[model samples]
Target: MLTHTPEMPHALQQLLDREAAITTLALPRRSFLKLAGATAGTGLVLGAFPPPAGAQAAAAGLKPTQQPSAFVQIATNGDVTVTINRLEFGQGVQTGLPMILAEELDADWSLVRSRNGSSDPAYLDPLFGLHMTGGSNSIKNSYTQYRELGARARAMLLSAAAQRWNVDVATLRTRAGEVIAADGRKLGYGALAEAAMALPVPEQVRLKDPKDFRLIGRPTTRLDARAKSSGRQDFGIDTRLPGQLTAVVAHPPVFGARLRSLDDSAARAIKGVKAVLRIPGDLGGEGVAVVADGYWPARQGREALKLDWDASSVEKVDSEKLLTQYRELANQPGARAFDADMAPLATAPRQIEAEFIFPYLAHAPMEPLNCTVRLGKDRAELWVGTQCPGLDAAAAAGVLGLKPEQVTMQVQMAGGGFGRRFVGSSDYVVEACHIAKAARAAGLDAPIRTLWSREDDIKGGYYRPMHLHRARIGFDERGNVLAWDHVLVGQSITTGTVFGQFMVKNGIDGTATEGLRDPYPVPMRLTVHHPKVNVPVLWWRSVGSTHTAYVMETLLDEIARATKQDPVAYRLRLIGDKHPRHRAALQLAVDKSGYGKKQLTAGRAWGVAVHESFSTVVAYVVEASVKDGQPVLNRVTAGVHCNLAINPRSIEAQVQGAALMGLSMCLPGAAITLKDGVVEQSNFGDFAVPRITDMPQIAVHIVPSAEPPTGMGEPGLPPLAPAFANAIARLTGKPLRELPFKLA
Candidate 1:
């Protein structure tokens, strides 16, 4: 179990205190009529009604209210609104979660609607107790919670129908949002919603078995597809207000640099420029905000400003120098992740010494970071696409010197996050708040929307840490491992943050060591060195598994090839029978891809790899052929074991999306490098991302299981590059160690 620090930052402590106070509010029991009307509109409107007086006192001795109406609402028009507790940043949770609830509620699929929930205590993640939407845990964590909510809602509806008909509740059954009595009488859920709201909430309700499920494992289209495709969807960057001013900041060229002198004469003279105010930035840096009527004017004004930066005190990091330092550190032992006797290494007949390098990567979601903050005398509202709304709200409150309760966070849809939006530092959110505060102080009294340009976002810090891995392995002629000594050097992502207190142990950040030694047991001595680098690092899509999987899977494949064994057969032998999921996923991919039976086209070879991340297993069978000195992925067949697919279409989409992102790692210019503490890449022109031409023909297959579902968002990504690399190695007859695949 992960424990929060006993002494938290002032902002975080205040947020927790606010959550505690919310848990103590005694909610009055309401009649069905009141509850129905309350949720009949867009969705359940939170904070619209006040708690009863002395409610806190009552809540001290009693359990807080568990109202089904808080999550489900039935309109008179037969529309069923389900509030999703996670941010819908292209993961399809808006549709996937609603499918789970509607499956149990027996609601009409066409009439079912979903909405993003705000930062309310009722929407806290059941497992983490925080309002977060990462780790691909949206479906896994909330599966049971949403199911129970639906069951309870259905039970209440049945009770109401039975009472209205003056019959026993057991004599009626629900189907498509209607209660059908045994005597041929039926009532739509809408007609009895008010009555249902008046009924006492059931403590327990029966859930449908997997065999009886109509939606859980079905392939359903995303509910937001039409809106998003038609350009009708409103993301955080699209937020607008009556008098909102678009703001863009002129940050220092280097991270944590301070502003020494500013000449804003030309900037203030620009048309539509509202205010130019200097504000504090992330990591003790200072920046100047340019507020104008629109983004164009704000950007124009920002470009006109002249400023000198003072970076004399900060460390200036060079990517090449950092890698050299990391390699040196990897040669020496530091923190011990695993310990085993290396006596066999000295006398072993065969040995392989290998070194791998991975460069820093930026998240670079489609939509850049933006936050719209509206400040009032004592109240503030923020519109942003944040994975952790509770923390963002609290950070906003702290920035504005207000109580947590005074801040309202309207969670907005995001184009994509890929772990960028959920930083422990909350840098972007806090930066927006700071700009809003400074704008208000400068007499620009309207909502301030701080936007990040594609350049700004690409150059912005918080990247995946660059890593260097050195491994010395001793094995027999038959490829039986005798000893393995490995060393990893990288900056710890959690070292000085809130998560570090729990995730870092004895100087080892657990995230850095994940997916290192698993499935295949090996006598390994592993040491890690975490250097405090100047570059800011955060979790990429799959966190450490992104690199760890590549190392493990590719190295195992190498060992198999060294012993003249089939990679698939070798993996199956090593996996043995202990890990059935890994075996099953790999076998399925192999079978579906016709790995052993089908002959590939000339110059194309088969590659296979499997990895588990976020509790889900993903295996890839790829066809690769080098063209013009570049690896081209012809096709990818994926075998996924997420336990049970809530929506097969969503699963397929996630796999396809993740696979493409993985392929991006193999393209040139994918890495984020630095020269003199300044990021070298600023936009897509330099920082390469996979385009349409780079995408391969991907086919996704899910393993059949009635067990609860796991996450599919990130597991599909970790194995893609490694599998592609394995195929390329077969072609070139040389192992590829670095990212972007240097063929030479």
Candidate 2:
């Protein structure tokens, strides 16, 4: 027995009092295109087709009030607005998606504008049937979808013009947002847009050949570059509402710790302090929130409060003890990821056993987490920079006791995410909803903005899990691996979350063993141990490949050195002819880097490594030197094969940015450690990130191809650290088995 309404479901309405006065804001629509009737007796709205079966099933329990459009809008002024289904977040999806649609639309690049889409059904990832922007799948998944959308829109526009002129549609062709007749008459898309909306959408539209592309594959500048550079961009942190109040919370030192007692007398005395309330935290804890007119007052009021916490029930994890436990676990057999014969290990002429350690890392985006919630009696609205708006919207509905359709998520621009904003737990959003509910209970009827400071953000839990890898490899003089036994000890990132159903199989997490064996035809026995730790962990950048690539590439380089062979030649022999992309990428980097022809400048040495991740291959050739007992990366050249380059400039920027982050992993004090269940580092003072002075000169070259595009975001990151470390190993003659490269 379920009560259903156009607005919401009955199960959610039970939590709300029907008699309560609804407080709805008269805010202007900020979600997407608005369909307003024009004077010309033409339908302004483009009707959408019925949802696909997958999308319908995903939205069965809770139907969305509005369906997502197919991402094309031709306004009366001839301005073509393209809506991106993913967050911009400094990645060029804002520009790249538009380039894709505009290419097929034959729209002039100068007249194209892009907007960030909200948590709508139309914006879900076509393959996953989920609203998300991760795994570098933005362009990879939406490339064809957007192109088809543009082609459809173009077809309708031409059809509209043909009907108006009483000519066959074949006689009308589009060029730069204009429908032209074979006899030289032309009509701008704007004049045909309203009329085009009445025609039925074509079942299929012909796409342009790769050779006819004017925008795709071009090295175009980002559309948001001017706004971001001139400080005109409004990130999530910059969100403001008419009656919004700033909020700051005092969380317990240990995660999931409850508040025992609180004294808020001093906090109430602070000027502009509105309300102080205790609210439930994300990880089954209770925290105090201070609400005020400004951030400083809220922060000041929070600092003035005195509270006692009870952390006895939670595990007090120590980084040192955790590593010790992992080391012990690595020594024993664990869940099998890959099984290979171990009998060949004893007969091998040479063997190498090495153990590698990687510490936890924080995503630490420039803009800390901030979510603004305005709750009414029947509906609510949220403004935030989210990677998964639909997921966050559902989580908000659950927290606010409202139906999913009653919530509106206005996606904002983000400084950076690096896999931080897309949490399965939806911890940050839930926390904000809790604070807002508490504020309403305490008689503060206004939007609440829960903000995180730099310290709070760094200390906040979801981190890249710490891992320990132990490998036993047996190889011959010719650099052929006989047998390799490897074990990885770490917590499974997807163990208890929704992703665990498909991502964790056969008692092993695929993320932990993604780059173990491939492209080299290695007979390896790989095992993994996933310990249940108290620390919250999530994906960081390239996920497991962040460390697995380092291990595989560096070890292969070691084998090449042991055999007295050129690293590139050894890699080619191991890769064989099956992986031409790898071979071409490696050879391109080598030739461009002048590896064999150029003489080293005194103490510098050349390093080479190549690896594939996310269906894209990236190879690096680096020059490094040791100065004052520290490794210094001087210059690097990258060869990339991501199929087709949507925007070469975007690819170049992504590679340079990812490479710098990879280099940051090699610097001292870059690791995040915990002692007694408390994060050791607070801000950049302790946690090291690369600065301008630390960046190396990097040149990116892409392999030309007409094939469909693959991911470029993460593939550039995997090979960078290993290539730099191999060069350092050459100078020191010692294998570096740990991150932040310790030399004694």
Candidate 3:
């Protein structure tokens, strides 16, 4: 293993390490390259992470990753292990990406395995140039990258076998884990891996034509499926290290509220309680972390603490008052996202004015937030299922007063994280580091595991920003949109983060207005209002589209209703030929659902909605009914146009899960309410999610396309709620405005 010296600059050290990695990949075979406290074992290891398209021109000296050896490693037993760059939090990238590579490498599917990557620069996203995962772009961005990696590795293996057999490299072909000579001699990959690694990595290689792909489009089961199904899969929350101590923090009642006084007499008296120390929390808030041998005692200690909070510095956000303020702001123009004439709205033959309220939502991954930090004299190590390890490491360095390179953020498999783990502030990671630092200062020198209970995870801040969208639309009898005026009011999720500069412009956040009046080509003038609030807000699952799509789709359906037009036909007419993907998806959903053909149950009505987000289009044709004083989604038929399907099963899984999450929004108690500056919902009892009894039967259909795949993680969610609401409206003859279907 190669290591960096103290006097060397990190960049220069990386350069030297890069050279060594090249040597290790091409000639020395068994050598490993170490960086940022990450250690590699004997096998082929990759160099830098994949770069974005034209990223080389974006920055000087940046190039696409050239070392194919870095990603694929063939063990002696013929098992292939692929290193995945992004976090594997239930999105099948761990399987899909490897499938892309292994498809080109022609490896046996059963022997393929996957491992996680850390904050090492080699793990940065190929497109975004960051160590992060969100936007549902993981497969879309990395498709070509992994394909190329596998192709190059295959070339190297062929060359190695050719040399061994004394023949031309062009005469060799690769099959499942073996290279075949023209004379029918076969050499296993494990036998040739060392020699293959010794060969110089080819700068370029030809990718396989889609027609020849064995794994790329196949519906393969995830490599982690069985372990996950049997509950044997390990998550970061299950991490255990010797001498590890658990901590439970008592947060202030309000956002940014500081602890005025703390009495830890009873807490410290607990048997396993090691110490109780004050620590900083999200939004400049202060809290007490109770350290104990395990979670139970730490939680008990936290419950025993007598505390008083000072909330004078923070705004006391009340949901009722805030909604009123948002409604008032909706009438006033704050910033222009789209400006078009709205004079025709008043004189149009039909008109509709709608206001939609989307409550703050929690990500609520199965595993609550957890981070384990072990501090050394000059360095720190962390184990967590973080979305962006590099950002988390930097934040940890600041909290530990160590150099960024001194901190190693080891990535782990997460249970789930729609968008919660990818925080701009690295809130949970920083909080864990702060607890570690304070414990060290208090002379409790042990590895600290900070755990958030289900209650803590739900009440903890960084929720989806509550949004109110008001739209006034006018259309003719033919369903041609004459004029539309729209306003969106919400807190900006990126206003104060590193992304603010890129995502916010001229006082308007791009995220807030993303899903408004697009693909429909309506002459819509959109105004956005970003009110400052003390409550913390972050992206949750589908981000702005969560509310924006609901508003846009439902309103369009209403216009279709008023104009006596079929919903699917109207949406297709608006989309036209320009947006083939949208039209195709909507048409597919309609065709597959047997809309205007298939008969439904006596009370069930057809609901239709289509939306495009993250460069992918999803259309939902749902059969729904109002049962037991609630809107019941009986079945969902989804038409997904993601261009190319990497793993159709994964796409189906994502759609099913995301659609259910969308359905959760329409159920009672789905909203996360704020009352007098405190979160009203603490657990699943008050903060509702979908139960097994509530799950609707769903069938996902992919539009056949040879184009590159788009995002699949988020697009399926946006259309579900609106489609359900549209059906509920048909049943009651009154359009539903708010979520959770407040039936009278």
Candidate 4:
């Protein structure tokens, strides 16, 4: 705002490799130009616009998904390359989605390859109609769409084969990229692909039954494994162009601080320095961009510049003071989210009052945020790793004084986003476009690469909102909740953005209250407070689940402990039959972890936590011990129920990665604090993340089902910290409330 810097363990690294390193193709900026109905610079834009020409064709009856030319490319040698719609940023969708398509296409696994898609109309999410890759919706939302794409392509191939053989289409069958006639004659898909494109796309094509699937649910190795592991993978930061100049922005230390004065005399004297530009910053403030022949000189030039900032216009957000303010706000009435009877809270057999404090968190992806923009007379092209490609393109066009149709956003495989690259503001992209425009005006007229160093990424404003949760609960001795009143105070992540209309309702942001209640059928009255703060905030990985899941799971575990009932039994009884996915996941984790049947090592204790986020449910059973006064996680067993498994290995790897990310929240030095409106932490040394040495032995077990797939990218994270904390609480005999656990 955006790898152990959101870097990863070995298993997690595999998922990341598969996500970013698409096999066998060094796709060019216009590699997707041949995509059916996918003309460069012509896709959906931010607000309202006339249907793009490509979209108009779809409206005229050629559904883009049904067009084989858009998704499938059968090379003359029987190799099939599939274009993935979503940005592959370590969720493994770059491979997992292709497995779904290739399964139906009957393509030979060894010859299958993948590449990233453009911000084309056909590449939009089939359900949401947006160029987005968040919410773990890559597989969940596009499963059927991609399947139908493969089915249509296969059908077309069969038709072409049948026409050539002078036989009925039904008389031919497909097997391993070949069409087989009833008489045993075989024609490879590559042989018939050109003719297949001439045939009309079928309006309806049948998908394969789950029982007949070959590629899915199998622990197959990723096709791009070799490329990424060999350090040959190229992220957006690696973009290089002829006569390209690198730019570094000298930002204000305070959020939204305007540039008061600048002295660039020494900066201009640097050998490689070309021009210095004053441009709009991430916020509405001003920042200076130093342009040079390369990154080293750009960085040096920026370091040499003398600048003064005016921060009086923006509020100085002090974390400690904000905490006090939030506590006071929590004491007052707020906009209602859940309105339940709280009469019983006044008098009950047992009562528990708790206040949880969570500080701002950074999405510090290993590869820092960067964007490269090349501008011509009337058009602009961008190379970036972004979650909102279309929006970014539209924003770029706006900044470049061109129409949306004149800008091309060449989507690149990101190193890791974790919501850092999906900013509603298009902050970094906008900065790059402005830099490009300013450079061209200064007679540079060359592509400009705007790079954010680790320090810039760390101190950048957009962060997971600091939240304060106050809960007063009154329950009977049986641990049955009678009345619970809860209040949450945090900045709204989608307040003024395009997503605010839906994400924010009445006056409360739904993100802050997403996982709070209803899962347990608890009688809870919830109130939310969205305070105006100078610190910019955005979604971080699991978003609100970062804190909500912790509160719910830990409180539930405390209730179970207070009632002297088994935690699992209590949760099961509370969950009941209404939520089978949660029950299945929890039971699987309990069974696989040997929770009750096997005794743990002498100092180790067990912790169990289950939560549902992004429609997928994950349960974690963990073993932990206090070593030298620090809580050390020993082992973890997870049971995930995300419906059907696309790739078991990918799911396992994703869970392992997400579990580590979740564990990071509990590690000391994980929080991002502010003193007088400036971020205090800058790098991994100060802002800690989990490395392999800190990771626990994790085993991910997926619950078998064929109810289609749900999100896997984020569900694994919510349950982790809670489970670990529950184990620590058992050993300490006190419930833990805050993150980055303080034993004192």
Candidate 5:
């Protein structure tokens, strides 16, 4: 509704309405296959398997009619196929997104399959005006649009079948992939697909009511579960083409640092090594590409190569000094996001001050970053799991001096993205393009494929910037915070990058300070965003909430302690009518947790926190204890309000995973600094992620609402840290300020 087209012709409107009636054949199709040796197809089919008969439309009302991408195709067979426009990195989005549409289209669930979409403007992100997936916006952003597309498709298909059968459209109804007449005559959707396509699309389409929903809002296994589990699913790294050569780049040790010299003579001596080209940067830092017959050979050649780095000055940075400097800078002047006009200090009788820290974290996606590029004179084709396909296309073309249209970005399954894949810098892809370009210059006969090893991925850090946070809260005897001031100092996540301006306002990056101040009934609120200029940073899994939730939620617990009130009651007092979902999630967590109840042990305690992001509201209650010097979190209960659900089971899975991730961030996962500004933590061995054994027993409750569901991926991340921090404070009888909430 925020950005909708005002009007369209009735003819066009009708075409939009008849979308669901098309039935697709389950033919193997690559929507965006590179045209190196193979011809490109005319995009994917638009076959939809609508929700079961009588399933209600998603409660979150959708636009009356709209044109979605041509990615959906219905063939002459009864198959319903969807071309997924977003990248899938083990988040189950490949299945989750289509289910939302199928639920409204009343598509037969059994006849559904999905394909990854291509880099085309037709399936662009409405917010950023491009086709890509990141920012946990997949569900929330596509919810209404995709549902309406399904409804429209259904209306069109039914109308076409009615026309063929010489029956009134009103008298004909669609069931599964068939059109059934009141007289008992029936035609399968596949038989009427072409006719439906020829008919005019409907502008106004009817949606199902929630009560009639048969397949949506239910916990069904992933549609791609079998393919993925059986190892038949092809990820970006699995791509292989005829005459493709593997390449590895030795990038600069530092981002801005350049290569001083390179000696790849030994690397060139490797039997399979095709070429050792000075790619203009360091292999690990940026300039040279080592090309060989395959991945193993390319890696071996890279290992044999040597280069001199001009990292003398940049190497001055040590992790300990960086952290100390961040703390010092936290107290300095910075950009202010929110400011409160507070009276003199005499206005408040009580004051409290606290400091916090969030260390640099890595994405460490299982698949790492890899891309296959075939650069030709007229066109360039890339197969990878990139979040910004348009940008990826542009960047790839930029290196090859080609137009954006000249680049074909073939989308593939990402092992995981978490924002790392979304950024414009295709470190691996860019290197591959350079290598291919250099190869073409040398008249090589093949394209280049680039791969990043786990070690290289870890050492080549694009981390969630470490942060130093400090807060001072003043309250009256009643414990209502009269004045609040907070400062967050951290490396600019977007300083010299593409999203820098949008990210930094007057010097503050919102990603650096989300949920920084509580949106409560407080009298005064002030927060500062101090940009730590020198260090490098990037968006991590949860973005800013990774740190903001830790600070705000923990402080709220502090406020509750000082006020002698139950944490749940305290939060309820401040949470008003801003968003019904927030209230519902908070209250549900409190109720389900049975706040104030006696627990199993005298030293153990429970803590509560709530955060809303990407339109979803979540509340978490954590019960934990300290044992053997490490924090042992025993149980966690969360309440989520996603409004209308596509799949409850998937939502639960996301929430459960996010909860564990949050817990891991709280203690186990810390990218410590060693000598020479090097990260001490390299792999899972050094950098700890929560194992299945460390997982807390979690019970998730979903609050059903009639609204369109938002994203469930990262909303569950914000509350777990603070809940544990507060619980630790109770056991130790000390205000726990630092992260990893280590016991003394």
Candidate 6:
């Protein structure tokens, strides 16, 4: 229970002073120039007029939004509670964050509990400059903050015990909720709780030396494992409230098509149908809501409702037509996303060319789209599972014509968001607000839960835009790459939408052009972004990397085959020094799996792909074969570097799950097909997902690093598709240049 202050031990101070002196005179002459430009710009000047002594910029993170609280609160009864801001959403962040806090707090592990925090500014992300949980930032971003919180709390408790015992704080030590003095006298944390609160907050704290860390780097069971297994926990689908009525909407079969008219006479006659409202401009399109005493009655009433749709314009739009148009647009000039002026070397003696097409994909979350809104004249409250609650609140208020504060958003456990939850325009939550406000204008209780049928959720707007890619690589007679050219044509994810404006300021959606900038540093490289401008699109799981990684990694694999070099060895030479973690993972995966040594059955082969996303580096090797003339993945091995490695088990779970999700998206996951602008796949029967029998044996190896934890949820997704696609090419002796690989 030693309450060490900011003052360092004299021995440590002397050691640091000697090290600083040694570093100052050992640099090269030009080092000072670089330091002046970079280090001096950090607000310190050596020879110039120094600012007054006390003018040091108030310790970097002193913003009004930053909070000093981030650890466990031990109640008098020994119940340890924690307030976490990161959304759980089945990512296990709720469990991972608390593990860090508990280890530093020195709490009784068995008595600890965790919960989500209220929407407060104290939870802002230091990186996003705002409060957000997406981009795989939950654990990577909060680990240190949460740990510091515990360390600060531990210091406070030690100070309190020192005051009560009247003993020198250094003679006291803490372990598992008790403060013990050298004389063997002990005091529980609960006994000193009040005194601890009165102590001044420390300006600095030291973390536990890694060798002494007990819980971290160790496999601890998930905090919510019991509740989920026993079916006691409530997900969004199981939510309920008093006096709540069920409602359902039978929206149009296509986007931009309005409801010209509808007949609800049969629906109104249903047994439990309370009201059938033909609302105008609901969700800025055709809207019809059937309200009933229960969900079953509303569902039954929806089946009887008939409507005349204004699908004239959309009637001409189709998936096949869009695909053809995208290919045509790829040849024409659009916005240039990244350019390297490779036109001088365009006429090389030897060149390789290929085209890759990606189809439209859906974010069919398990819970579908649902929201419960209770609206009054100037006040509203919405209960839903959204990734961005602050943004959701603003959108809710705008739709209801109320001030932002008038709307209260309760973030529930999302079944899944991916990138689907951040959507602003044409959002389901916006539609729910419209429905609730409309119901109130009709003078009812004004509280209704809008439930989107599985079909509506699938056929609705905002899909992963279909993309077409054309690439040409110029090589010398020595087989060295001389130039690289890539042309991409696809619907800009941010065009003509609220988010599109911010993302396309320079007429380029950085997301759409990522992974194309060519960090490979070839002699000449050019990437052109041609905006297709078709249907409304949104970000899916890995955003642009989902498609871009496939193109880049698969093309590199082709080059490896052309050079007759090992794929791993070839990528190792091309990686340069951009990402050391990626290199480490590549080497580890290649070594552990014996990647190029063994062969599976004839006509079966393996492929390797590596990528860095959300701060984490991941590499995947897949073993697959053509089954019945279709690519079938039989096994997968992955190496991940989520630095600092919080809960190795949880990281493994995320990597395994993300790999499976990626596999399903590549092989059998659902896609949106349009015929005359009408989506054909309405539900799971048509939009297939991976079943248990479809999963391969996935093995995960975690490479530990001290680089601070990065994102683990999504980095594993980008490489799976390319790995599987490359494996298919090896097995069939032909590169499958499109998604949903079709073997011949």
TM of each candidate vs. truth:
0.95, 0.92, 0.93, 0.93, 0.88, 0.87
lDDT per residue for candidate 2 within 101-194, as digits (tens), equals: 8998899899898888777666767666567788888999888888877886788788889999999989788899899998999998888876
Give candidate 3's error at residue 207 in angstroms: 0.7
Which residue pairs show collisions in model 1? 32-194, 32-197, 32-198
Clash count, predicted structure 2: 0
lDDT of 1: 0.85
lDDT per residue (tens digit) for residues 1-744 in model 3: 000001112232322332222111121222211121223443343333343343222212324333454566776456687888899999999999999889988998888888887776556566666667888878887888888778877887898889999999888898999899988999988778667755665666898888888887888889999999999999999889899999999998898999889999999999999999998888888989999999999999999999999999899999999999999988885899889999998799888888888888888999999999999999899999999887788778888998777887779899998888999788889999999999999998899999999999999988989999888888888988899998899999988776776678899988887888888889989899999987889998888899999998999889888888888888888888999988888888888889999778899999999999999999999999987788889999999999888889999999999999999888899988888899999999999999999899888999887788888989999999999999999899899888877988
Candidate 2: lDDT of 559?
93
* Candidate 5 stretches greater than 4 Å from native: 1-69, 281-285, 312-315, 344-347, 495-498, 524-529, 532-534, 577-579, 601-603, 672-674
Tell me the tens digit of each residue's lDDT in model 1 across 573-677: 888999999998998889888998988999999899999998999999999999999999999999888898888888889999999999999899999999999
lDDT of 5 by residue, 1-744 (tens): 000001111222222222112212221112111111221343234333333444332221322114432545665556677667688887777888788777776778787778786665545554444555766777877776677777877877788878787778899877787788999888876677666655544556777887887777778889878887898978998889998888877766555466778898899998899998877542234567888899888888988988887866555457677777777776666666777766634467878888887777778888878888887669888998887776777667778888767788888888876777866465566777877888888878786778888876776666787778887788866667777777777777765565664666677666777666556756544455554433455787778888888888888788788778888877877786766677888877777776676455765788788987666778988888888877788888788887877788788788888888888787755554545655566688887788888898888888877677677788889888888888888777677777666677
Evaluate model 2: give its lDDT: 0.84
Determine the backbone clash count of candidate 3. Answer: 2
| lDDT, candidate 1, at 387 | 95
Off by over 4 Å in 4: 1-62
Please name the candidate that would achieve the greatest TM-score relative to the true structure: 1
TM-score of model 1 (CA atoms):
0.95
Candidate 5 has an lDDT of 0.71
Model 1 stretches with alpha carbons more than 4 Å out: 1-66
- Deviating ranges (above 4 Å) for candidate 2: 1-70
What Cα-based lDDT does every candidate model obtain?
0.85, 0.84, 0.83, 0.85, 0.71, 0.71
Deviation (Å) of 50 in candidate 4? 21
lDDT, model 6, position 661: 75
Better of 3 and 5 by lDDT: 3
